[model samples]
Target: MKPDTSTIDIRAMALLIILCASWGLNQVAIKAAVADIPPVLQAGIRSMGATCLMLVWMTIKKKSLLEKDGTLLWGLICGLLFSAEFVLIYWGLEFTNASRSTIFLNTSPFVVALGAHLFIRAEYLSRIQIIGMVLAFAGILVAFHESLNLPDSGMIKGDIMLMGAAVFWGATTVVIKASPLAKVYPGKVLLYQLGVSAVILPVASIFLGEPPVQALTPLVISSLIYQTVWVAFFTYVTWFWLIRTYPVSRLAPFTFLTPLFGVLAGSWLLGETVTIYLLCALAMVGAGIYLVNRR
Candidate 1:
């Protein structure tokens, strides 16, 4: 039997960077639509739509959607965590700016690093790698220095929610890494998340009294398409493949770069300001990614 990959190679690195960029831009899309659709409902819509697309694609590919894999339990857990992450993120954005959201949301890697060290065999982090994770997070703070100081009264609550989402995000990755889901088809793994969230988010949205859709403007429509097609479906499929094919600990830290890309995408797409902090933060993030991946 082939041993699992223990490091990030060139192709995985490139794919991770692309996933980060896609995720960064996805945040802006979420923010763009939240004003028109209630946050939880919007997430529900994204998941619901992505689930449809995945269903069709898997059908075309003749992939089994309901195979009796031993991964059922873990898959459901991942879905719940995935649902929670989205619910927290969109709901939190209602109370916080994207800058602060990025800062808190990207803390997921620390959870992955710690969890993988304890549970996953042969995935321990050296001291330098731990520093790399911290450095990458520091880059996120620097990237959003202004947002960190924003004086919104609800900012604390929003930040706490975002932090909770990060934990769920990390825990989901660790669960997949340590469970039977790691050995399943990537599309199936993503289906677990998309499918479960598909049901849960919408039901919760109803319980929360969130409107299914408020405005349905072009921006909202485009945002939903971007999220469902690209972020939720494509990139997530790639993300699952990556975690299964490589070390989850090595892959998770690159998410630290997501908010940096979010900041830049915000500047390009939303006219948010850019500053010297981004450049310095980029350098630190680069260094951090390197240190963690060092042989």
Candidate 2:
């Protein structure tokens, strides 16, 4: 039987917020890591590390490591989508400013909403949800309009790549909603993606042929660890858990927070510029999210 949304509990919300916060901080972590580690290599290593940990955990828990009930095909498909999405994101980051990347990347929610509306029976967005989505999109614009407008900024390339990445992520989620894999454990879902990414990223990194690890500073190492643990392990698992427990549509709107925090942190920590437009965008996004989810 399909799970009822009305039965969602407090633990789900707590998990959601924690995951969102980690994803928010993830942009900064990626930026910091990419400064020293080659972007592809960084992605590869992080995925490999996460995969190892997840596999170990799954083993201890005695979850089916070898895909019971013909789920391996679906898992492999999801993993391919997962791998492609991050590859684009990591490479895009090298060309783009983190704050602008976050703003543009937040476009994924809209794509997901649209996809759900078109494809899924259970995931409809009400008029209020639509309004909230527009508000959040507008908020992103407000938050990054100045940076976006600046001439000679490399942001154009990065923003494009991130936008593409968002679409990829959106499509992946839609597939998840449609696939039989939804019936499987969330841990299985994550493992498929991480394990595939582990193999794909490393091979791709080799072809990209990054220079030997030149200077692995403490900052870089810390950032990589943060991405591997908090972003990869904690946040991804939390996200899968939320998908299992809550209404996907209601919770997806909250993901606007990821980019909101990303923009703020980039400005504060990395000395990225803050502009009036961004402040206005942030206000609109917060208000929109509040209105949409207030029920």
Candidate 3:
């Protein structure tokens, strides 16, 4: 079937739903595996595996990796930002429930929308978008209000770290869109991220005193494989392709489903408690995302 030029077709919508589900399930997988492998170390290993897989895919597709693209500097920057983002995510997951972290991480869109307004003249946010951003920020506050009041709270720390990761994630998006990296092949764009993180994360894991090998249980191994293949490789590539083929404004709203799925998956798979605050925050953030992405 021919691709729709300006609208989301049934196939695209179905794929988007599937992609969101995979992403949500990924958080549960990480939570399950982190007991056997330290969070940063687990992330490092998964990135390393993903890097190799990306290389293999590139080879199969006959994609050139050594092209003298003027985007190398931007690629490296993106890699660093990408690495930092995941580092925070994996570490924060240690202290907070995966459901909570996912909610905070979904704030990246607001960050991106605001940053775009400031830097990209053509991408200014409307008044409705501004209200949406405020609502989302309020949701974050609602989610963290109690945790923040307690002294030396790990939950607060985790929430802050996840929020920082969301910022980095958004910044990475802005960089890719603004820099020459936008002109590079999407596969190579991903390769740069995975390759750089492959090196940086392992070293960071070592320095941070994370062991190279923990108890490699069946669950751990399965989680690692799922993350490497599904989350990092397939889902990410699909997202990049969607960005290329669809109106991002239309596709962006569907992202709200991800955190909802994340919360549900975490509660179901990990037996995490879903507090009222969390549900309230989810509702606000989900509504905000819709408004922010509305055209």
Error of 2 at 202 (Å): 2.1
Q: Give each model's whole-structure lDDT.
A: 0.88, 0.76, 0.76
Clashing pairs in 3: none
**What is candidate 3's lDDT per residue for 1-295, written digit by digit as tens?**
8664466677877888899889879868877887678777777787888889989989999999888989788889989999999888877876786546766787777777766667653656668877876686676656555544442587889989999999998888777766676666788888888989999998888877776676888898899999999998998878767655654444555666666567678788878777798789778867775676555
Worst 10 residues of 2 by lDDT: 2-11
**Candidate 2 — number of clashing residue pairs?**
2
Could you tell me how far off, in angstroms, the CA of residue 120 lies in candidate 1 after the best superposition? 0.4
- Candidate 2 structure quality by residue, lDDT tens digits, 1-295: 8544643455666676677767777778877876577778787888888888888888998998765567788788889988888777877777887667767778888887888778777777778878988898888777666556562456677778888988888877777766776677787888889989999988877766665455789998898888888788878877876665565666676787777677668888889777777678778977777766666
- Model 1 has an lDDT value of 0.88
Pick by lDDT: which candidate is best?
A: 1
| True lDDT of residue 8, candidate 3 | 66
Error of 3 at 184 (Å): 2.3
Comparing 1 and 2 by TM-score, which wins?
A: 1
